[model samples]
Target: MLITIGIIIGLLIVAYFAFVNFYPSFGGDVSKERQSQYTDSSQFEEGKFKNDKDVPKDPTFSEILSMTRKFFFTKVEKGRPSEELPNHTVDSLSLVSYHGGTRLMWFGHSAFLLQMNGKNILIDPMLGEVPAPHPLLGAKRFNEELPIAIEKLPKIDAVLISHDHYDHLDYKSIKSLKNKVNQFYVPLGVGVHLEAWGVPQDKIQELDWWQDTSLEDLRFVCTPAQHFSGRKFSNGQSTLWASWVIQSETESIFFSGDSGYANHFKEIGEAYGPFDFAMLECGQYNKLWPDIHMFPEETAQAGIDLKANVIMPIHWGAFKLALHSWTDPIERVAIKANSLGLPMIAPKIGAMIELNSLLANHQEDWWD
Candidate 1:
């Protein structure tokens, strides 16, 4: 009997190894040579990337068990939307023909396409149907269709990735987008995954926090974010996570990529104040992990700290990663923003946003 139990345990261990190794979505490993380059970064230490603050502390065994129980056993009312979200289909001809000023389009959750200074850039384009290594392991996306198909996208000037989390950095999306993108800008240690996925090493550029790089007239700054990164269970924090500062001479934009509330917003504002627009993460939050993902009110406050001329709440209205109601994030944030007299815009999925119109506080509560 004991031998049979041991055999069962051995088989389980082998299966786990095989799955992680054979699965393309688990991502690639960072070579020792590549990891050595990160030693100079203050955020890199003890062979893994570290946050500025000692946030995201590992939960204890009891805490983990409790969370697991709550997730699998506890029912969350309205955790997902009752109906499919409404979105505007992107006109491919318009995208190709329009030579207007800077514009933006949200592709639900943390994905966006930005046209600035004659360049087309994609930010954290996780357009996959599921935010998991395998589709069966995750819930379906709220929106069944993307505004534009990945194949329909025009030639891309650059792709900016915030981190390697599955929800933010999807493998299928990258495979579809890579051939068309001229450059990929990712946080330190993240390029290895792209390189492993057949992206040429030369086409990828990796940056440490506060590091700045430019393509033509545009400046891309890899700024700080209070978050963690991992694609699989064993490799947490092996890579870095970040917010981004994108700037043309005329427009400045900030994208807070999956961050908790932190003083980094004020620091970013001080260094690069009065941004033309900012996209702040405002969802998938719970009290269990307060330090990693901000509550909704914190999202509004983050806008004030960034000194943004206008702010849009993102990271919600798409997936059910947390226990809150589907609309809780935007609802709470809008109230706080109104009380603070901060201009906030909450466009529907796939809505085209003219940068100039943001100053007039363009908003759509389409979730209602």
Candidate 2:
């Protein structure tokens, strides 16, 4: 029995080492490259990008392991969520080109189908049922399939990635999209993982904070997001995490990928402010990682930071990434924005919101 136990222990050590070595540590600019055409990082003054020390202390693996393991290994918890299919069918916003031009369809979590200037962009596409590589390691997938399936998706022009967290970056999603995606805009070390998953080196575009490039008529600027990334050990800062600015002739959109409160928004707003619409993060927040995520109130504050005229709360409403009631985010954001007189829309799942005409009439508590 001791001999058998010894063999098992040896295997675990090997597996653990493999995990550490598999993902590169967060450190350098190996996969990240700077572009010469990129000039001003942001239009704002100093202190725009919040630093690491300001970010809230994340739950060390030791701090949350028991809960994580119990949740993962035990069946005491039901495998699925209780929320029903949201009644909001996506409102079809007509594109300038029926095929494209500044429109987005949220697929849940931080993923969206963004079309601008005739280019189809997919952002942080995590359409998988579960965020884990296998069912054994993580929580169950969101109860609903992405409003649209990957296979059925129209040809994509590019993929904008925020970071390497399993929730934001799904290996299975990338693998399936390898042949379909024309280009990938990702943070530094993220390309390494994508390469391992069968993505080509030429197709992946890595940008540092504030770097940007033009694609066709659409322009993509990688902005800073206050967050961290690591799918495995030793890769804490290997890859960067950031938001994105999508701009075109008729419309400009700001996406706050996953960030805590920061002064960068004002800078972004000034530089790319007066956005027609903004998709802001407003979910899975807790006091533990306070600086990494903005509370529902803070999410609204972020909208103001980007000077968004019409805003829709993403990140929440899709996945139960936090312990709050499923509806807490939308409900709280509605209350806060209403009180602050912030122009906002809380569309139900799949609901289409038209930015051009909302001042006259809009739905009330549809999610309620």
Candidate 3:
């Protein structure tokens, strides 16, 4: 009986190793050539990119064992929505025809369609059904359907990726979008994955933190976010993670990709204040790793720090990456926003949110 148990355990370990190694969705490595490009960056030391602030210390072996045990044994009933999440379908033709103003559409989680400066921009578009390299490895997305199918999307001007995490930068979505998108703007070291996935080198522009680039009238500034990145276990921190400052002549927007509360928020506000809208990450958080993902209260504080005219909580209403109740993020953020007198909006997934009307049409609690 003991011999049989050992044999089964060894096979399981070998199978898991093979799956991670052989999976195309695990993405490509950051080559030595790519690492060379980041030599001048303060965040790049030795080989891997480093966070501006110190991240939480790596979990000890004992902590890892405890976490693994708890993860499999713990009962988590409220971590996901009970029923299929409702989402509105976007009219692709109308979206393509839209002009004269800035509009934003949230496809749940961090994926967004920003129609600005007469251009269509996608940010962190992880539109896959699951947030892992394989479907069976992670929680499924909450919605049955996306607002618009990938095939139905309008010609994408640019796709901005924050990091290479499966939840933020999906391989399947990238493969589908590469042909449609005119360009991709990503953080330094991230271009390697796109290159591996078949994006033309000319169409990809990689930037280190604090670096800014312009495509026509729009300016994209890669800024810092306090988070870690890795698709598989071995390549952790190989790519950069960032928030972004996207500015048109008339309006500026801040996108907090995924971050914990940090002083960088105030620093960004000081540098580029009075943003028209700020999309702050506000979900998939827990007390065990509080320094990596912000709690909902911290989300409100981050908005305040960014000096945003209106704040829209994102990184929720899609996937259950943490142990909290599915609706806890929005509920907590709303309470904090009210207390702080911060203007906030939580639009239903797929709603066409006119940038000017964020404060006026803010009270729809569709998650209820």
Candidate 4:
């Protein structure tokens, strides 16, 4: 009887490890494309980037364990039921003029399509069923229907990614979007995943901190952000994180990718700020991971740090990544921004927000 019990226990442990070992591609050095993206670390160590089980576990695993325990064992909060989405159809809104003006349309979460100087750019698009490859883990996306399906989007000029977090760069989203994107502008080492996922080498443009590239009248500058990067546990901090400055002759826009409170905001503000409009990170924050994601109030502070005239809080209203209520982020930020005299745009799931209109009359409480 003892031998039978031991044998059963041993098989179960083996099966668990096997399950962990086999999963969505880790984008590690496997395929030829992935190998080509590898940079020698002299400091490089083998098995530095892969899924969680094989990598160095977090130093504060106890904290993560405690949090997970509380979430499963104790956390039981209810979300207030929102109004049923109004009956509507996607509008065929024609472009007014791209002479020198800029406009932004949110697709919920951090996916945005920015039109300026007759070009379209997408930022940090996590358009997939789940942020992670598996549906069982990671937060579910907020709006099941994207603002517009990727097929309906106009010809895209460039795609900007801030980091390699599952929430920021999704594999299925990239695979679905592979052939359509004209150029992929990413930070150093992020090209590995894109390459692994089949983006052509020529299409992947990797830049370091403070690097700038021009596409017609607009320029994209990769600036630093106070954040870390990792798709799997093995590669924590192996790649760079950043914010981007998009500039044209008459207007400038700042896309604050996922970041924590860092003095880097001031540096970026000094370099390419006084922006006409800035899309800042404003949700999925918690005291546990405070260094990576900013709370609602800090989102406002970040706007001030960037010298932005008008700010639109993003990274919220899309997915429930933290323990807060669905409306907590927007509600809290709305109040703080008003008190601080900061302008904010609180649009619905897929509303078109005109830059000129936002700068003119700013009282569209569309979230209600």
Candidate 5:
């Protein structure tokens, strides 16, 4: 019986490997020449991307085994919402007619729509029903429907991708938005995946850390994030991860694309901060991997470090990627923000928020 169980486990491991490595949805291959271009970057070394700071030693084989065992054996009943969370949908047609100041719409997790300088921009647009390569293979989205259907979205001026993680760079969402997007802005080597997905080469702009690009009146600076990247195990860290600074003439916005608490936040603040609004990751964190994701308190602190006037906690309320209760992130973050006297907003999903109005009408505790 023991021998039979071992054989079955080995076969399952091989099958899982084959699925992730060969799956088209996992994303495109990075060529040797493409990797060479990244050699000049401080974060790229030994042919793989490296974090700004060294973390605790990579999880040991025994530690990994223990975690895997617990994952399968543990009962996490509150990890997801019991019912579909409520959301407000916006009319896409109205968005096109009103040429106005900066406004934003959240679609749960890290996906957001930012309208600034009369341009519509999408950040980390993983709009599909699942964060995996296929809907059948992984956890489904917490909500059964999106606030706005992909086909109904207005023409996107640009799509910004922070990394190639399945949750942040979804395959189906890219295919759906390809024809409608005028351009794509992504971390270095991430353009390879877009190219494979039928996006035009001329439409993709890849940037290294601290590199800035312009799209009409908006200036985007690809900043650092303390995180790793990869869709498949074999191609781990072949691409870069990042945070972003989106600046218009009158306002600056910060988007913390998946990161742990790090000094980089302070450094970014000094360089290009005093932001009008900031979005910080505040969910899917675990003690085992403390170096990659931040606790809710850390999320609040990160906003202060970025010198943001108002902070909005994101990266929660959409998926069950961690063991914490569905409401833990916002609940904890709200407490931390209050204790620190940080002005924060937990906008209802799909609520259209204007940047100028943030100071006056941002504190709506819709989750309660």
Candidate 6:
């Protein structure tokens, strides 16, 4: 009986390894050369990337079991919209042809198509229906359709990725977008996954935190974010996570990619303050992971920290990644932003936003 039990344990270990290794969605391993590249980054140490601020402490076996019980058994109220969300079709022609001013379009959540300085750039373009590796493993996206289908998109000049989480760095979306995109800019060690998915090494440029690179006249700076990274259970923090600072000759913008409340926002603001617009994560938060994802009020404060003239709450209105009500994030954030006299635009999923006219396009309470 003891020998049989030992054999079962051995089989289970083999199965776990096989699933993570063989699964394409789990992403690729960082090569030794790539690991060597990370050695210079202050954030990379002991063979994994890290946040400078404190993150959640590792849970004990009992604590893990308790959280697992709550996750599987607890009933969350209004976790998703009761009906399909209203959305607008993408004006692909205008998007492709326009060079008059910098325009932005949110494809729900953190995904965006930023047209600036006569160039088309995609930021965290996770257009997949489910955020998980498999369709059955995650909830369906609230909106049934994207503003513009992947096939309908025009040639992309560049793509900016913040991290390698499945929700942020989707495999199917990358596969569909790889050919259309001219270049991919990702955080350190994230290129391994893109390369594994068939993107050419030459097309992928990886940067450490505070690193800056340019595409034509526009500037892209990889900034810090207080978050962890991992697609599989075993490989947590193997890659780096970051926010981004995008600047054109005329306008500067910030994208806060899944960060908790930290001084990094203030630091970024001081280094590159007075942004024209800011898109910040404002959803999928809970007390269980408070160190990683900020609450609604914190999102408002982050906008202030960035010294942004206009802010839009993102990382919500798409997926039910947290137990909060579907509209809780926007509702709570609106109150905080209003009290702070901060200008925020909460547009519909596919609404076109002209950066210069943000105040005029102040979105109504559509989520209500």
* TM-score top scorer: 1
Better of 1 and 5 by lDDT: 1
Residues 1-368 of candidate 2 have per-residue lDDT tens digits of 99999999999999887755553321123322332222243321131222445554556778689656644455533223465556444333332236423456667667877766667788888777676545555556554555655766667789999887777888778878879899999865567777777788899888877788888877889888888776655445555688898887677888888888888888889888888888888887866568888899988888887888877788865555665665677779878888877888765554444446533344567555
TM-score of every candidate: 0.97, 0.81, 0.96, 0.84, 0.95, 0.96
- lDDT values, one for every candidate: 0.91, 0.70, 0.90, 0.73, 0.90, 0.91
RMSD score of candidate 2 (Å): 5.4
lDDT accuracy of residue 30 in candidate 2: 31
Error of 2 at 217 (Å): 1.2
Q: What does candidate 5 score on TM?
A: 0.95
Off by over 4 Å in 4: 1-22, 28-58, 73-100, 359-362
Candidate 1 accuracy as TM-score: 0.97
Q: Locate the minimum summed-lDDT window of 10 residues in model 5.
A: 359-368
Per-residue lDDT for 1-368 in model 1, tens only?
Answer: 99999999999999989999999988898777878899999999887898889988988999999998887677888888888888889988788877899999999999999999888999999999999899988888998999999999999999999999989999999999999999999999999889878899999999998999999999999999999988877888999999999998888999999899989999999998789899999999999999889899999999999999889999997788888988999999999999989989988788788898875535657788
lDDT per residue (tens digit) for residues 1-368 in model 5: 99999999999999998887777798887899888888899999888888978853477789989887776567786778788887888787877886988999999999999989889999999998889878886889988888899888999999988889888999989999999999999999899899988898999999999999998888999999999888876788889999999998889999999999999999999999899999999999989889999999999999999999999999998988887888999999999998999989888888888898885665766665
Clashing pairs in 3: none
How far out, in Å, is residue 331 in model 4?
1.5
Candidate 6, residues 1-368: lDDT per residue as tens digits? 99999999999999879978898888898876778878999999888888886575677899889877876677889888999887989877877778778888899989999988888899999999999888988888998999999888889999999999988999999999999999999999899899989999999999999999999899999999999998887778989999999998878999999999999999999999899999999999989999899899999999999999999999999998887888999999999999999989899988889888998965788987
Rank candidates by TM-score, best first.
1, 6, 3, 5, 4, 2
Q: How many Å off is the CA of 315 in candidate 4? A: 0.7
lDDT of model 2, residue 316: 66
Question: What is candidate 3's lDDT per residue for 17-88, written digit by digit as tens?
Answer: 898778788878988887888899999888888877778678999998987777656677777888887788
